[model samples]
Each structure stands twice: as C-alpha cells, then as structure tokens.
Target: MADQQTLQKMRQLVDQLNEYNYHYYALDNPQVPDGEYDRLYDELTALEAATGTWLPDSPTRRVGTEPVSAFESHQHLAPLWSLDKVKTEEELINWETRLHRQLGDLANDSLEYMLEYKYDGLTINLTYENGLLVQAATRGNGETGEAILAQVKTIGAVPLSIPYQGTLEVQGEGVMRLSIFEAYNKTAQEPLKNPRNGAAGALRNLNPQVTASRRLDLFCYQVGYCSDREFESHEAMLAFLRENRFPVSPHLRKAAGIEAVAREIRQMEAGIPQLDVLVDGVVVKLNRYDLRQEAGFTMKFPRWAVAFKFEAMEVTTRLEDVVWQVGRTGKLTPAAELTPVEVGGVTVRRATLNNFDDIQRKGLQKDCLVWLRRSNDVIPEIMGVADEPDAACSPIEKPHHCPACGSEVVEKGAHLFCPNTLACKPQLVAGLAHYAGRDAMDIDGFSEKTAALLFDALDLRSIHQLYRLKLEALLPLEGFQQKKAENLMQAIEASKHRSLSRFLYALGIPNVGKRTAGDLADHYGSLERVMAATTEELVALPEIGAIVAESITTFFGEERVREAIDALLQSGVTPESAEESPPHEATAFTGKTVVVTGKLSTFTRQEIKETLAALGARVTDSVSVKTDILLYGEDAGSKLTKAQKLIESGKRSDLLLMDEAAFRRLLSE
Candidate 1:
C-alpha cells in the first residue's frame, strides 16, 4: 500500500494529466508540452505499478485493452428519436405554420427557436451513473444499442467522470475531424472515402485500439434523461452540458422569428467549409421545454423540431446493374450502373460500390433504389439502400473471375484481384496510361488507345519495354508518321530524367498516391533508399501507417518489380532527387478562405487551386459569408455576382474582390 504522501502525489498527477488532455484534445489548445506530460504520466504509471492500484478516473485507462469478441446490446434509459427533415425555405415555413396551428390558443404568443448544426456522423448515447461514465452505445434503434463503453473510453475528450451525482443519458455525435481525416488518408491502406464512415467504422471496430487511432471527438447536444435535474429551455440544457465539461458546439443560436431562423440557416450553410467536421444541415428546435412538451411527439419524430437540410447532395436512384472494372493493379472494383438522376446540379449515372464487402455491408441489390451522394466533385458513391428491394430485385453477384482477362480471381482482404498480371489487357492499358499522365511523367499524347495499340501490335508487355521502342517499329503503327514518331521518341526520352517523386507515383504502388509518393521521395531522397527501406523505417515517418509500410516493403521485395526497376535504370532512366524548398511562410492568402471565379489567362483551374492550397489557402467552390477573397478573371460568373450582393448587403463587409493583377501583386508582396 502507498503512503498518504505518495497517494496524494498520484492524485495530483492524475488531475493534472486529465486537465492537460481536456485542453489539448477537447479544446485544441495544449496546456503542457508533450515531454512534460509524458514525465507526469510516467510518474503516475510508476506509482500505480508500485501500489498495484489506480484511480477510477486515471488517464492510463485510455491506452486501451485487448480486442473484444463482440459488443453486447445495451438498452438505453431513454429512447433516442429521429428528426424530421425539410429541404426548402417554403417547407420550413409550412413546418412553422403547423407549429403555430398546433399551439392554437398560444398562436399569437412569441415563440423562440434554438438552432444547431446537424452533424453528419454516428450518433452516440452515453449513460452516466453517480458521476461516473457507466455505459456508452450507438443510437442503434433508439431503444437498444451495441455497448461500446470500452471504445468510447479511448476518446480523450469524453469525460470519464462528471460533477453530477445522479444518473444521466447524454446524446452526442461521434465525428472525425476533416484535418485528421486527410492526414489518416495519406497512408491508410484502404483510405476512408468519407469522414462519417471513418468515425462510424472506428467506433464499431472490435479492437478499441482501432477506435483510439481515429481520434474521434464527441459534441454533446442533448440530455436524454437526467434523474436529478430538469432544464427550463434548450439553452439551459446546453449550459448544463458546458458546466459538466462536455464538448459542446460554439455555434448555437437562438432566434425569435421564422425569418431570423432562416437567416441563421443560410449563414450556417455558408460557413460549412470553416468547420472541422461534416455537417449536413441546421437543426431547429423549440427553445422552451414547456413548449416542447405542449407540441408533443409524432410516431417517429418530435413535433417541436425539424432538420433544415441543405440542397440534396444525396438522391435515390435505381441501381440498374453492377459492373466489375479492373484497375492497373488488377484489383476488381464494383461499379453501379444507375438510372440517371441529378445530384448537386450534375447528372449521375454511376457510383462506386468499393468492394464485395462494401456491397454486403450496405445490403445493396440490383433494381433497388439506393441513395447516391456526390461531394467535392469526386465520383458519386452509394451511401446505402433508401428503400426495401422488391421481388424483382436480385442480389449483386460477386465475380469469381476477372471480367477483362477471364482469369480466376484471388481474394485479398476485402477485394478481388486478377493473378494474370502480364496477360491482363485492362491492367496493362491502365498502368501505361497512369505512367504517362501529366501528374506522373508529363508524357504527351500517350492516351489509353495508344497504350492498347502498343500492347496489341508491338507485344509491349512491360513498362520498361517503352524505352526499347525504335522509330522503325513505331512507323509501322497506325497513328505514327515520321514527325509524330520522332516527337513520341523525344517525349519518352525526356521522361527518363523526371523527378523521383513522379517516378514513384508512376510505379503504381498500392495505397500510394501522389502525396504519399512525394513524402516517400522527400524522406528517402533516392529510389534505392526507398526500395531498401525497412517497414520500421517507413512506419517511423508521420504520414506512413503500418499497412502502408507493409505495402511499400512488399512491393519492393517482389522479384518482378525489382527486375522491372533494374531494366528501366539500365535503359538510361535517371530520376532526379526532390529539390529542397524553403518552409512555407504566412502570406495574405494563408489560413484564409478563397474562391476563384471565371477563366484565367495565366493559370488553369487546377493550377490556381493547387497554388492557393500550397500557400495555405482553403479554396472552396462557392461564395460564402466566411469567404475572405474572391479572385476573379475573364468573364466572371454567378459567384462574382453573389459576392457583390453579399458585399452590397453588408453581410460580408471584409470580403475582398481581387482581379488577376491584384492577386499577382499580393503574391509578390
């Protein structure tokens, strides 16, 4: 047993570490250096070891435990309800009108509305008893959820104990920050396509370690059940949550009229890009608890509140069929052939199903109305089934063989791959095209058709074979005149002296994108060093994860890859090392929101966007209240008009309108 003085020291260390954690994780403000915190943590850990005991609220509990076989079902003290949603201002007005009619005698009474962001992440219900966190669960079917106390404990922001002594059930959304999401995707083996999915997948993982790795945060929004207290209004409940040291959103607003509520919603939509988490829309609810009680509940949702959703990013469409496409890696990916529907002003005819496991998880079937979402101009993705499949709907069949090469497929993790790498036409064509892409080697005129022609006619079986091409052989090909052949040969020769980063990207390494490839090139400074790097060395880098490290090592270890690399080097290919540049300095654009409009003479859309990003600017596609600068070029369009209107209305007084010349001056300065 520890002496009183020793025990006191342990208590002090526990409290200090917890406070530091709260500051760093919950508030994004570090109160102590990592080294100092580590020292205190070590002291506490040592004391626990010596005494064979630890406090219930000790931060050491956060290191996580072994994987659980399964999650037990937990019944909530109070039921969680789903909210009704509306898309348009007219529908919102109708909802308010209905509320006024329901009030009847109090129709003339002034009503107040509470507004909050509708976070697009997994919903969680936490149960606390006698000031200690007793249980945590998903909002599964409202009444019952899978117990995830172990997983929830791994989240540093989540309180292990609170001030209140009575039992309480608090509701919040579990979300992964967009910044963290981007960092994680840099080296994730199967990169998470969505932040919501990242949070949801992490929380449900059998291993608590997996949950901890995601670094999810929770935003408490409601007290579902409180044994010893009752709140007068929604604002009061939020105050109570804040008092309890819970992480609450800072954007809560109260409005007296429907017009004010609508204005708040518009502002919220405009400021979406500034947020660190995904939010679908704004949630509006009655302010007073008494009014909520009077309004009562419907069968599915509370009558007092409704979610005012933004314009539809997701729409229901029939999945007409599933097509398996082979990539450069020979991996087979399922693509959904959808009955065409408009989403975010674009017509979407197809969506990515990801893999066979994804299809099974989403319960997608042919002829079903599935919800497809398109965001950030990426390929549309099927979120889930919107409705039950009719009898005519058939289960999506997984391919047993490669669709393109007719080779027997091999299962690797959640995906299927073709074993016949050399003979696969689709794989060779894709690989060749990828190597010649502007981002890879800047090889001009090397289209997919050209790749196919070379493969079919000249028996070009490998990437290294491209260097073996001669003018006489190329002259016999369909599109190769003497001048064209000479230009093609010159382009191919020029690619040999490309940067090491581009060469790395052109290698078609699994899980490696341009960013990760650049990171590898920068870290190693040479192809030989990167190829020879051990898994431990690779994993030591901040951006590289265990799976990605293993992938790099495995790819380099393959005999075929080694031989191909050697052949390329022997054919006079010399990839130059990365050029060191000065660290990025803060500029007028740094940490500011920028939106570009119209065609530019100096830079293409992609070029300008990349430049802004390099200078630390958050480039968005739309004009918003939070936008700092609108860079306009020739024939500026609606975005320019919107920015002008915002400025004229004094909604965005600080917003700047910069023409090409002005932007150039700012860059120079």
Candidate 2:
C-alpha cells in the first residue's frame, strides 16, 4: 500500500508534469528544464512500478495492446472499397496503356486524373436520414461495423445534420490535428502518440461529451450511396460532397496524366506538414465516371483509382541496445535503443524489433549500423542491418524469463508470452488498462496511471473492484479531486449500458477481435449465451475456426473470468441482445459464384457486391471456370473477355450480362 507521503508526492508530480506538458506541447514553450522534467517523469515511473499504484492520466499508457482483432464487418450502404496501389512510373504508364487499348479510337484525346491527399485515419461511413445525422460506422470487413454515432456526434466539425433531404452516404477520414495533439499534451495530460490514434480514440469514446472536447474533424472524400443527383467526374463528386456541407480536404487537385499525378503526390508529401491534418499518401482516381467504369475493379480495389504510399522515412542508426517490454496482452516484444538519427522527416532513436524471430531474422546486434523506417507514423522499425559493421560488435540475445514477473517465457510462433498470465503484474495492469480504453469499454477518466495506482495502492485485482470504489475512499488517495472522483464513478456507471459487442471485445479474449465479437453477438444474441456455448458449438458458427473456438471456450472456462463476469453482473452491467434475424432460406443464386468487374452504370461496386451477397451468391474478385456469372458493367475489360471465352467453350451457361435496368430489377426481386 502507498504511504500518505508517497501519495502526496505523486499528486505534486502529476500537477507539475501536466504543467510542463502543457507548456511544451500546447504552447511550444518549455517552462521547466528538460533534465528536471525527465527526473520527475523517471521518479513517477519508478514510484508507480514500485508501489503498483498509478495515476489515471500517466503518459506511459499511450501505446496500447489489443492488436485490432478483426475489424467489425459493416455493410456500407455504399461500399468502402480500397484504391489500388502502384509502386513505380512503369505501372502507372501500363494503366494508361490499358485505358487506351480498351477505348481504341474513342479513347478520349485527353484523360484527366484527380489527385488528393489520402488522410491516414480510420474510414467512417456517415448516414444522413432526412437531413438528420443518424449513424456513423467504421468500414469493418467491408460489410458491418460497430455503431459509433455517439462518439462521432462530438466532433465539432462534423455537421450533426446536413441540408439535403435525400439519403446520402458520405465517406471520409476522421482526423486529428497535430497541433491539437501537442496542445492536449502541453496541458500535462498524456500526449497522443499520433494523429490516427488520437482520432480513433476520440471517435470511439462512449461519452460524446469527452469526444466533443477533443476537437476531432473529418474530410469527406466520396459519395457512396446517393438517392439523387449525378456526378460526371471524380472532381464533381468532391464538389458535391462539399456543397452538401461535408468537410472536404482542401488539397484536392485535378491532374491530366500519371506525370501530373506523380508531381501532385510529391508536392503533397513535401507540404503535408503544413496542413491541419496528417496525410500518409496520395489517392489518384480517373476523373471521368465513364472511364472508371471502363477500367472496372479488381476483387479488393478499384481499377481506376490507386493509393500511392509515400516512401517510408528511413535512416541509418547504430543499434545501441535491446530491451524487453511486457504489454497488456502479456506478450513480450523486443525494442531497440538506437543512436539518434533522422529518418524521413523525423528524428529517430528507437524501433520495435517485433520479437525473437524478428531479431534473429534481422541479425541485429549492439554497435551494428541498421536502417530504420516508419510506416504511417507508427513506431520506427529496423529495416535491416548495414552491409558493413564494426568487427567488435556483439549480437543481441533474447531473454528466457519475463522481465517483470520472473516467469519462464515461452515462444508462441513469432511472439513470446508469459505463461503466468494470472500472476504477472504488468499483464494484469495492462489488461485492466485495455479494458477501460476508449475503443473498448471506454471507462473515461480511468487512465492507466489511475488503474496502476488502484491496483497497487488499494490491492484491486480484477475490473470488478473498480465498481466497489467509493468517492470518499478515492478522495483520500493521491491526485483524487472530489469532482474527478465523482466523474470517474459516473463514467463507470455509464459503461454498464455499453453495447454487448463492445463488452465482448473489451473482455480481450484471444483470437476474438471486434469483427469476431460482432459475429459472436449476432450468432448468440447475448453474452450469457456465448458463455454457455461449447467449443464444438462455437466452431460450428460461420468464420469461427477451431483455433478461435478453442480460445473462446478456454477464456470462458477460467474461474477468474467467470468471477469477473459475475462482478460485472452484480454492478448492473446488463448486456442487450442483438436483434434476431429471419430463418435462413434458399436463394436463387445460392451456391453460385459471381464476379463483378468494371464499373456498373446502375450501382456502385459496393452495392453490387452487397446485393449479390444478399442473393446468396459468393461474389469473388477474380474470374475462373467455376464462376457462374460475370456481371459485366460498362467498359468491361479482360475479365469480360475471359467470361466470353468460357461461354464459347460451352463450359458455362450462367454467364449473364445485365444493363442498368436489368440489374435494378434483379435487386428489386
């Protein structure tokens, strides 16, 4: 237990730290000496580690675990399809060549491309019902997603309602400004590690009140499903979304060819930092909708549009040392402490080595020169060791035991885990922190520091003890203001009404991510039913493989887990059941394989895919002899020719071509 003196000292540290952060990040002014700041931070880290009690807003909790299980599948009213990727000028030229080959003499004398910044953030689909903002969901599995309407409503820049009367599907990236992240950090609160995380966390908040305060913003880029109005080109679509009061990125540009598109990408990369939001790459799309249809689409991405990822920022640095850090998942990852070097645009000092296998594969060692790169503002990663190294350099070795708990570590594939999951303090504390994270249960005000403090200071074990906390008892503890204490309790209380899918996700069951959680909820209806299911029963469900089924069953079988569920129930955490669906029935297209290629004049690619799925057809991106139908849209390409060949060979009678009118009728039936 923390003594009174230690608690008091911690409070002072928090206040002082917050002030320093506010100055450095928010105001770009330093109040305290860097040495002094480091000293205080180190002291706090040590104290928290020693005493096991942490303040809620400590900085150490930023890099969270929960390797995004599967993204919840969301059936976008408009499909959130990916733009194809291109690496070199040759590929871009080849695309242009293909366009000319298909169009022949009719190929427009001049084709234009629309280039825009590809904001590196979560993709969200916003639905406006009768001019009123009604729903927002992530592009999960391109099919379904968690409803994050409450959190999305908090973003001041996102209009609560648009002026349009017709149903509209607006697709955009939810973004956070670097300036805001810095400002938030300067307030002595934890600084967001990156804009993507900041935006994701803000948009997933259970409390719109908290999300509203974060100043998150959006830039709508596409019109998914539109009831009325026609756009002739990609440029027109951008103008439409903007005219409809959707915030569009200002860096949008029109280019004539691959050269112009490449130049635009370069310009954007050079000037991205000056923009309000972070951008990872550039998106280039065929301007004319007719051209887009002609170009058609691959299985996963559109043929007419492509996302050109900027070259990863890389630099050569010395691998000074390697260290092991235990995460909330009890997975021990290796981190390299490097001699400071500049990569891309940022100074780099550290990089993640992944695990033991990665270390061995990379042949990393002390004093060895290594190339490091950062992809999408994530942690810098060691690319490879330099060809030449000092002869005196020593190789880095992996540890056999856990650093925190001294438990024997075992390698599971490429990852190393502490088998002593129940007893490891770091794992326990990390798990609790993840459970209360914004994307999970989103127990606001329950920061990592606070969770640590509660765990160490109060002997709190499971998430259940959190509910037993009284404001009066908390007030006496370090850094607990009466208002803050009350707010924390209220947040916890509010989380009881959290969605059943989110609750299951927050449980952090192995192999069961957000997408799997939604599927389980849809299948079983409630948590109780899921818990009651056996491994065999779970495996019988769609997409639940034996590995995932075993993990789910094992998680439920644990006594500690059972006790945690009981505690949550006692705290009045009621899980709402998922709405029931009609019984499964046979469909006309059942057991048939359908491939959609090129652009359909009748519907967007997403709509066609979803319609086919509804009709019980397995819609594939590629064409083969097994394919029963190849839905030919305008400007059908090589895939269309392939389908014709199959027809000529008398191999298939199911090859069908439907124009806009015919396809609409098919869907209506």
Q: Each model's TM-score?
A: 0.47, 0.52
Lowest lDDT 10-mer window, candidate 1?
A: 61-70
Among the numbered candidates, top TM-score falls to: 2
Extract clashing residue pairs from model 1: none
C-alpha lDDT of candidate 1 relative to the true structure: 0.82
| Tens digit per residue, CA lDDT, model 1, 81-119 | 878767789989999999998877765555799999998
Residue 65 C-alpha lDDT in model 2: 19
lDDT of each: 0.82, 0.72
Worst 10 residues of 2 by lDDT: 62-71
lDDT of 2 by residue, 460-506 (tens): 77787777888788888899888888999899888888778889988
- Return the top candidate by lDDT: 1
Candidate 1 regions with alpha-carbon error over 4 angstroms: 1-70, 104-109, 182-186, 191-193, 315-351, 356-372, 375-379, 383-409, 418-669
